[model samples]
Target: MKLKLLILLLISGYSFSQVKKPDSLQLFFDSAKFSITDAHKTQLQSFFKDIKLDEVLQIRIKGYTDFIGNHVYNNKLSKKRAKATYIFVTNNYQFKAIAQQGLGELDEEIAEATIEGGNSKHRKVDLILSYEKPKEVSVSLTRKQRYLLQLPKLSIGEKLRIQHTNFHISTPNITNASKEDLEGIIKILKAYPKLKVLIEGHVCCGDKEEYESKIINPDNLALSTERAKNIYNTLIKKGIKANRLSYKGYGFTRPLDFPENTIAIQRENRRIELKVLRK
Candidate 1:
């Protein structure tokens, strides 16, 4: 029965991958003013009203100036503008990370033709938002795989063991056979976009002190945590939304068997489990 289930998962993982374009927004500044004006603040607020900061993987801010002043002055002005925008956003919203840069004056060719007033278009800060791409498409699934996709049916706090997912001995590296099981999980996540899960990592052994000398990291909990994190990162790379997923390591604290004297029992204890966080 386990072999059949493993085969089904392996086949289910063969889906598709995709790419998505980054989102962009712009804030125009006055000729020499770097401070964000009231109108600009309003625009920024409106632009970010619908965006979820947690879902944003990266935020890039590029500040530019018109070709009116000396290179040094223009460069400083651009940096100030970028800094002002960065401060406003960081103070208002909570995101993973942000990158800011000052490009100084725009090239003559690229800079908007100086009109009667000034190069208003060229004096601006550009904002780009990046998110993880969704990497699944419509695909046939085995009966068991279909069952796995029914995450909505499960109640919160319920745990589902990834049967075939296993890690190397005392290491975070997952075996080749376990990669299929992870892909199968990814497919299920893609199928039910609303479903959220907490990945829990477990290991087999005696007390922490007993395994401290045997393990490379010297920390049993860290090893288990790394194992869980490995799966978490794989899910992210496979296009799973980071906001919908989280992971933690339990070490050998939550073992299925007490005396793991046999290799089979130990293998059973060293496993990955997913707890339903949202359905």
Candidate 2:
């Protein structure tokens, strides 16, 4: 009876170990439309909701268009689709590494058949996520301390937003309220001697022209960059090594909230974030 019980337990363990989670997803779009629909957005949220950032190894996205358009048009459309998906994923989730490519039109035979059948599969983006299962470990630490420990494990391109790290209006000056957050970051850097990061600054509420045309109003860009530099300088002042840090400003280009219609949303957009470069 003991031998039979042991065999049953071993078999169950092997079966559990062999269980596989899905590694790929396909998101469809309306004809010639690059934007993700509400339905697809909900699907995406459900798909990614359970994924842990630390376990992700890489994400690759590929966009494809139907054969109804000319090569040039289809190629550009595919790129737009890819960009839209990429932006949505990056804004919503944190991951180690991600890459996107526009594969343009589907194969001619497949496109023709799909079109004849009124299928929309060709107008789609494929997202392939690869990750490793993290090992189970028991540790007793405060939430902030655990976050500090995880900082060193992040791969390049992964970002950690410094919550409440906001600045004075239209200036690079750090707000008094944000000092504690900065100190927390400094503590993490001091704890992990080999960790390196790039400070990124962003702002909110700008017109399309202001966002795109640097020549028309370069100050926004400069301001953002300076904000990041302010954080870099503060870290240096706090005794973090200068060689382990770099900074850049993105202005109003990467807002967390689009249109910037509300004060609260705009406040969320106007903040500083850090990208892990080395661990």
Candidate 3:
């Protein structure tokens, strides 16, 4: 019992000793549009001087926007702001800062188009310095595992998904779909009730010669549409709202697993993809 207590005390002490103070910085924008200024640069230099930038540290810079524009646009603007700050740090300070990121418009201290107590704090950049290395913080996932579980983000409005937008919709023969795959899709819809999905279907051709022309073949549309319509009907029969669902068949135009030009590749091309339009 005494040995166990001693070990616990030593572990706790080591953990406590690793903790270091992080530096905080705030940059404000007063113009209609945001821009990085000389004052911001000077403040950053002063802050870094107090802390040791020579020591290994990770710099996290986040940009925030007001609620004025669309969320997607605001998110992009925030990234730009963050990148600008990172460039300034690297150029002026001549230090290799790792992992610069933008948080976009997610965090806002002030309301857009509204001033409280004669203060508006929406357009700004937040800089943080951490002594922790990134390797200790990143989580790893294998390629096969990540691909099997990919899904688009469902937003209440348009452009809902943030990742994998290129894979909007796809369809393959439902007859060939495994029971497990069907159940997995049904599970996704049931778990997220507000989700509106658009299903697309595709068909595989044995020969790469099929796609020789700029124009698409009519059979491609027929096969793709058939699979998509079937899936849409199934979901409706299962009690999902008809208004919340739509389907389109691209035939062989959109392949999920394989590139065209061979038989095996064509088989992969024939698949189904579900896109979330609303949540």
Candidate 4:
């Protein structure tokens, strides 16, 4: 029972504090000179000292004149008075009083109240309450265009299309790919499920193979086939339907580089490519 009563008291006190309105205070104008008298100074000192956090407080420092000068001129003077008040509060009170704003002569207390001249009490600077500084929070997230490819664990029915060429093939290179590259690839794949991709694998021309010289070494073709198979297995493990994914090897037949029979050409030929067929 005692614990329940304590919790209730805490809740009630918090509610009351949150709903409390800011205190409003009025200060007489210091005339056109915009100088607060000694009496006003004492009151202001007391007000500043009493200011507390989580509470709103407002002060309207105004300027007034007898109907001696032009109405327009009086309005301008009132604005100056408000500005001066703001400066005083910010400089003297630091951030103790959040800040102050000048409403100028627009918010006249008396629409047509006149002192010496037919002037209104519109020239003033009204102080307002400010909210507390919001707390900062940290978050982790992937940026736009971030790519990740979970390899050795590709999803079933997942199809990845490369450039439109014989090199197009889904090889399980993701196993060795960095997180960034993997994510990028996965992101694209997920975006288009209906799209069908053909993965092709290739091999370098001068690779060492036992029957190369005699049997017209299909080293490139064999290497390319292996790469394609690796990718196919990965995708199958990922739960992608086997029918959705297809693999093919250009076997150095299709060269991304020169079409000649040079070692450099073979290197370029030894690459896997993906192409969208159904999409």
lDDT of 2 by residue, 46-148 (tens): 9987777677788888888876655446768888998899999999888899988776666544456434544477888888887864443344444544554
Candidate ordering by lDDT (highest first): 2, 1, 3, 4
Using TM-score as the yardstick, the better of models 3 and 4 is 3
The list of candidate 2 runs beyond 4 A from truth reads: 1-150, 212-216
lDDT of 1 by residue, 1-279 (tens): 999999887776643223334378889887799998999899999888878788898887888888675544676888899999999999999889888877666644334343234577879898888786444446456544554554554445446778878777889999997766776788788878888999988888756444323232347689889999999999999999999999988666556554567998888878888878776
Kindly indicate the candidate among 2 and 3 with the higher TM-score: 2
Best by TM-score: 2
Arrange candidates, best TM-score first: 2, 1, 3, 4
Q: What lDDT score belongs to each candidate, Candidate 1 first? A: 0.75, 0.76, 0.57, 0.47
The predicted structure with the larger lDDT, 2 or 4, is 2
Model 1 ranges with Cα > 4 A deviation: 1-139, 142-147, 208-218
The C-alpha RMSD of each candidate to the native structure, in angstroms, is: 22.0, 12.2, 13.4, 27.8
Over 4 Å off, model 4: 19-24, 30-33, 53-68, 96-104, 107-124, 132-279
Against the true structure, candidate 2 reaches a TM-score of 0.52
lDDT of 1: 0.75
Candidate with better TM-score, 1 vs 2: 2
**Candidate 3 per-residue lDDT over residues 1-279, each given as its tens digit:** 999999999999999887765567788766235567888877777777756667646666777666555434566777788788888877766544655554444322223233342224767777766665532212233432233233433222112111221222343334432444554555556655667777766566523344332134677777667777877887788777898788876555333333355665545556665655566
